[model samples]
Target: DQQVKQNSPSLSVQEGRISILNCDYTNSMFDYFLWYKKYPAEGPTFLISISSIKDKNEDGRFTVFLNKSAKHLSLHIVPSQPGDSAVYFCAAPYNNNDMRFGAGTRLTVKP
Candidate 1:
Protein backbone atom coordinates (compact mmCIF):
# COMPACT_ATOMS: atom_id res chain seq x y z
CA ASP A 1 0.00 0.00 0.00
CA GLN A 2 1.27 3.42 -0.81
CA GLN A 3 1.44 5.52 2.31
CA VAL A 4 1.71 8.59 0.12
CA LYS A 5 0.37 9.21 -3.38
CA GLN A 6 0.67 11.93 -5.96
CA ASN A 7 -1.95 10.98 -8.53
CA SER A 8 -0.47 12.96 -11.41
CA PRO A 9 2.90 11.81 -12.62
CA SER A 10 3.63 15.21 -14.09
CA LEU A 11 2.39 18.67 -14.99
CA SER A 12 3.25 21.44 -17.44
CA VAL A 13 2.66 25.16 -17.32
CA GLN A 14 3.66 28.33 -19.07
CA GLU A 15 6.05 30.84 -17.64
CA GLY A 16 4.45 33.50 -15.41
CA ARG A 17 1.51 31.18 -14.81
CA ILE A 18 0.60 29.52 -11.58
CA SER A 19 1.67 25.96 -10.85
CA ILE A 20 0.01 23.68 -8.39
CA LEU A 21 1.12 20.26 -7.15
CA ASN A 22 -0.96 17.94 -5.03
CA CYS A 23 -0.16 15.10 -2.64
CA ASP A 24 -2.03 12.71 -0.35
CA TYR A 25 -1.10 10.37 2.43
CA THR A 26 -2.72 7.54 4.36
CA ASN A 27 -0.30 7.44 7.28
CA SER A 28 -1.57 9.29 10.32
CA MET A 29 1.75 9.13 12.12
CA PHE A 30 3.23 11.79 9.88
CA ASP A 31 3.85 15.00 11.82
CA TYR A 32 6.04 17.08 9.55
CA PHE A 33 5.63 17.74 5.85
CA LEU A 34 8.11 19.14 3.32
CA TRP A 35 8.37 20.00 -0.36
CA TYR A 36 11.50 19.60 -2.41
CA LYS A 37 12.32 20.84 -5.91
CA LYS A 38 14.71 18.91 -8.13
CA TYR A 39 16.17 19.19 -11.59
CA PRO A 40 17.24 16.28 -13.77
CA ALA A 41 19.80 14.02 -12.02
CA GLU A 42 20.62 16.49 -9.25
CA GLY A 43 19.46 15.84 -5.70
CA PRO A 44 16.29 17.42 -4.43
CA THR A 45 16.55 20.63 -2.44
CA PHE A 46 14.23 21.57 0.39
CA LEU A 47 11.77 24.21 -0.71
CA ILE A 48 9.09 24.67 1.91
CA SER A 49 7.61 22.71 4.77
CA ILE A 50 4.70 22.65 7.17
CA SER A 51 4.08 21.00 10.50
CA SER A 52 1.01 18.93 11.24
CA ILE A 53 -0.10 21.59 13.67
CA LYS A 54 -0.22 24.28 11.01
CA ASP A 55 -2.42 24.62 7.95
CA LYS A 56 -0.01 26.50 5.74
CA ASN A 57 3.55 27.65 5.12
CA GLU A 58 4.88 30.07 2.54
CA ASP A 59 8.19 31.39 1.27
CA GLY A 60 8.37 34.01 -1.42
CA ARG A 61 6.70 32.56 -4.55
CA PHE A 62 6.26 29.14 -3.02
CA THR A 63 3.55 28.08 -0.61
CA VAL A 64 2.51 24.79 0.92
CA PHE A 65 -0.77 23.93 2.51
CA LEU A 66 -1.55 20.92 4.70
CA ASN A 67 -4.99 19.58 5.44
CA LYS A 68 -4.25 16.92 8.01
CA SER A 69 -7.88 15.97 8.43
CA ALA A 70 -7.89 14.86 4.81
CA LYS A 71 -4.25 13.80 4.67
CA HIS A 72 -3.76 16.09 1.70
CA LEU A 73 -1.12 18.67 0.86
CA SER A 74 -0.34 20.99 -2.01
CA LEU A 75 2.36 23.30 -3.28
CA HIS A 76 1.57 26.45 -5.16
CA ILE A 77 3.83 28.78 -7.10
CA VAL A 78 2.77 32.14 -8.40
CA PRO A 79 4.04 33.52 -11.67
CA SER A 80 6.30 30.57 -12.24
CA GLN A 81 9.36 31.23 -14.37
CA PRO A 82 11.24 29.19 -16.94
CA GLY A 83 13.92 28.55 -14.37
CA ASP A 84 11.25 27.02 -12.15
CA SER A 85 10.70 24.09 -14.45
CA ALA A 86 11.60 20.90 -12.62
CA VAL A 87 10.28 17.92 -10.68
CA TYR A 88 8.90 18.54 -7.23
CA PHE A 89 8.60 16.04 -4.40
CA CYS A 90 6.50 15.92 -1.27
CA ALA A 91 8.20 14.46 1.78
CA ALA A 92 7.28 13.63 5.34
CA PRO A 93 9.56 13.24 8.31
CA TYR A 94 10.22 9.71 9.43
CA ASN A 95 13.06 7.65 10.92
CA ASN A 96 15.45 10.58 11.34
CA ASN A 97 14.74 12.47 8.10
CA ASP A 98 14.11 9.34 6.13
CA MET A 99 11.57 11.22 4.07
CA ARG A 100 9.01 9.34 2.05
CA PHE A 101 8.61 11.01 -1.36
CA GLY A 102 6.09 11.10 -4.15
CA ALA A 103 7.19 9.89 -7.57
CA GLY A 104 7.21 13.55 -8.57
CA THR A 105 5.37 16.32 -10.41
CA ARG A 106 7.14 17.89 -13.37
CA LEU A 107 6.37 21.50 -14.03
CA THR A 108 7.32 22.88 -17.44
CA VAL A 109 7.45 26.59 -17.09
CA LYS A 110 7.59 27.35 -20.80
CA PRO A 111 9.07 30.68 -21.70
Candidate 2:
Protein backbone atom coordinates (compact mmCIF):
# COMPACT_ATOMS: atom_id res chain seq x y z
CA ASP A 1 0.00 0.00 0.00
CA GLN A 2 1.19 3.51 -0.74
CA GLN A 3 1.73 5.44 2.42
CA VAL A 4 1.44 8.82 0.80
CA LYS A 5 -0.62 10.01 -2.16
CA GLN A 6 -1.48 13.14 -4.08
CA ASN A 7 -4.99 12.85 -5.46
CA SER A 8 -4.57 15.72 -7.89
CA PRO A 9 -1.86 14.93 -10.37
CA SER A 10 -1.66 18.46 -11.67
CA LEU A 11 -3.00 21.98 -11.24
CA SER A 12 -2.78 25.24 -13.15
CA VAL A 13 -3.27 28.84 -12.16
CA GLN A 14 -2.71 32.33 -13.46
CA GLU A 15 0.28 34.17 -12.16
CA GLY A 16 -0.31 36.07 -8.90
CA ARG A 17 -3.07 33.65 -7.99
CA ILE A 18 -3.26 31.17 -5.16
CA SER A 19 -2.50 27.49 -5.65
CA ILE A 20 -3.36 24.72 -3.26
CA LEU A 21 -2.03 21.17 -3.25
CA ASN A 22 -3.35 18.32 -1.18
CA CYS A 23 -1.76 15.20 0.26
CA ASP A 24 -2.93 12.23 2.27
CA TYR A 25 -1.05 9.58 4.15
CA THR A 26 -1.85 6.31 5.85
CA ASN A 27 0.93 6.41 8.39
CA SER A 28 0.26 8.04 11.70
CA MET A 29 3.80 7.79 12.97
CA PHE A 30 4.88 10.57 10.67
CA ASP A 31 5.67 13.60 12.77
CA TYR A 32 7.55 15.90 10.45
CA PHE A 33 5.69 16.98 7.33
CA LEU A 34 7.54 18.69 4.51
CA TRP A 35 7.07 20.08 1.01
CA TYR A 36 9.61 20.00 -1.74
CA LYS A 37 9.87 21.53 -5.21
CA LYS A 38 11.62 19.90 -8.10
CA TYR A 39 12.71 20.75 -11.64
CA PRO A 40 13.50 18.29 -14.36
CA ALA A 41 16.84 16.52 -13.92
CA GLU A 42 17.40 18.15 -10.57
CA GLY A 43 16.90 16.92 -7.03
CA PRO A 44 14.03 18.20 -4.97
CA THR A 45 14.62 21.27 -2.83
CA PHE A 46 12.94 21.56 0.54
CA LEU A 47 10.35 24.31 0.72
CA ILE A 48 8.59 24.29 4.09
CA SER A 49 7.59 21.98 6.91
CA ILE A 50 5.16 21.65 9.79
CA SER A 51 5.64 19.56 12.85
CA SER A 52 2.86 17.36 14.10
CA ILE A 53 2.68 19.46 17.25
CA LYS A 54 1.58 22.44 15.20
CA ASP A 55 -1.31 22.91 12.85
CA LYS A 56 0.38 25.36 10.51
CA ASN A 57 3.75 26.59 9.34
CA GLU A 58 4.60 29.33 6.88
CA ASP A 59 7.57 30.69 5.02
CA GLY A 60 7.42 33.64 2.71
CA ARG A 61 4.62 32.87 0.26
CA PHE A 62 4.43 29.20 1.12
CA THR A 63 2.46 27.62 3.91
CA VAL A 64 1.72 24.10 5.10
CA PHE A 65 -1.20 22.93 7.15
CA LEU A 66 -1.59 19.62 8.88
CA ASN A 67 -4.78 17.94 9.99
CA LYS A 68 -3.51 14.99 11.95
CA SER A 69 -6.96 13.69 12.78
CA ALA A 70 -7.74 13.24 9.10
CA LYS A 71 -4.29 12.10 8.10
CA HIS A 72 -4.26 14.90 5.57
CA LEU A 73 -2.05 17.86 4.80
CA SER A 74 -1.94 20.70 2.32
CA LEU A 75 0.44 23.22 0.85
CA HIS A 76 -0.68 26.66 -0.12
CA ILE A 77 1.14 29.11 -2.32
CA VAL A 78 -0.02 32.69 -2.40
CA PRO A 79 0.49 35.03 -5.30
CA SER A 80 2.23 32.24 -7.10
CA GLN A 81 4.89 33.31 -9.54
CA PRO A 82 5.70 31.76 -12.91
CA GLY A 83 8.93 30.49 -11.44
CA ASP A 84 6.93 28.49 -8.92
CA SER A 85 5.77 26.20 -11.68
CA ALA A 86 7.19 22.80 -10.85
CA VAL A 87 6.48 19.42 -9.34
CA TYR A 88 5.66 19.74 -5.66
CA PHE A 89 5.97 16.74 -3.41
CA CYS A 90 4.78 15.92 0.09
CA ALA A 91 7.18 13.96 2.24
CA ALA A 92 7.70 12.63 5.74
CA PRO A 93 10.22 10.51 7.52
CA TYR A 94 9.35 6.84 7.46
CA ASN A 95 10.09 4.72 10.55
CA ASN A 96 12.39 7.51 11.67
CA ASN A 97 14.90 6.43 9.06
CA ASP A 98 14.03 6.79 5.37
CA MET A 99 11.89 9.48 3.86
CA ARG A 100 8.70 8.70 1.96
CA PHE A 101 7.19 10.91 -0.73
CA GLY A 102 3.87 11.14 -2.43
CA ALA A 103 3.25 11.11 -6.16
CA GLY A 104 4.08 14.72 -6.91
CA THR A 105 1.61 17.37 -7.97
CA ARG A 106 2.64 19.47 -10.97
CA LEU A 107 1.72 23.13 -10.57
CA THR A 108 1.71 25.35 -13.62
CA VAL A 109 1.68 29.10 -13.25
CA LYS A 110 0.52 30.72 -16.44
CA PRO A 111 1.88 34.06 -17.47
Q: Evaluated with lDDT, which candidate comes out highest?
A: 2
In model 2, which range of ten residues has the least summed lDDT? 91-100
Model-by-model lDDT, in order?
A: 0.89, 0.94
Give residue 18's error in model 1 in angstroms: 0.9
lDDT of prediction 1: 0.89
For 6-106, candidate 1 gives per-residue lDDT tens digits of: 88888888888899999999889999988889999899998999999999998999989999889999999998999998999888866685878888888
Mind giving the per-residue lDDT tens digits that candidate 2 earns over 1-111? 789999999999999999999999999998998899999899999899999999999899998999999999999999899999999999989976799999999999999
Clashing pairs in 2: none
Regions of candidate 1 where Cα sits further than 4 Å from its true position:
none
lDDT of 2 at 80: 93
TM-scores, all candidates, are 0.93, 0.97
Name the Cα RMSD for model 1: 1.1
